[model samples]
Target: MKRYRFEDLPDIIGELLLKMNSIEKLLLENKVNNVVADDDLLTISEAAKLLKLSVATIYTKVCRNEIPANKQGKRLYFYRGELLNWIKSGRIKTITEIQLETETKFNSKNIYK
Candidate 1:
């Protein structure tokens, strides 16, 4: 092992602290990135961007209970999965599906005759 003079060790100590501080910063950033990449809840602006709607409109929907979301304290939170599911729930039936349903209804009426 190499030994440093007592006075020289102070400089080494400062450098070590700076390096440790930098490493800690990097670790914190990585943790934040991981949380953001996961299926975490999103803010109103984030939900707006994901849904391609105006923030005002989002607020309105939340007010009238037209959108699926939660209010924690005074802030709103949305799950990306639930937003996608809400979009899916608004899907309109295809022409073929409408036609099939009509036929089934008519056939059922005939059977009852």
Candidate 2:
């Protein structure tokens, strides 16, 4: 079995969050409606738009507990602020490094020796 670490991915995810925050700020300064409401609650579609991710992916994250979300009766809602903070936490940072380590381990195996 191969183990993967989440710390291996670059800080690209953090950069992406900063970019998104910048866009949101610019939109607010330009009097364009921010994607998230003042209360910070967003529907799945709205969050997907803000994250530039597929709704299915968002739902998957929600299900996997990768993102913070709560159900209000039958409605599932996510908090924009929480989502942004979560992204800033760099959960994907380990991916690339873990993959590299696994590859190196497999290559170092003495299958021919």
Best model number under TM-score: 1
Backbone steric clashes in candidate 1, count: 0
Q: Can you give the TM-score per candidate against the true fold?
A: 0.60, 0.46
Q: Which ten residues in a row have the lowest lDDT in candidate 2?
A: 30-39
Model 1, range 1-113, lDDT digits (tens) per residue? 88899989889999999999999999999988866655569999999999999999999999999999989999999988788879999999999999999998999889666
- The C-alpha lDDT values of all candidates are 0.92, 0.81
Provide backbone clash counts, one per model: 0, 6
| lDDT of the structure predicted as candidate 2 | 0.81
Encode model 2's per-residue lDDT on 1-113: one tens digit a residue: 76546784456577888999999988777664454343488998998998899999988998898888888887778888777878788766478889998988988995974
Model 1 root mean square deviation, Cα atoms: 15.3
Best by lDDT: 1
Q: How much is the lDDT of residue 65 in candidate 2? A: 88
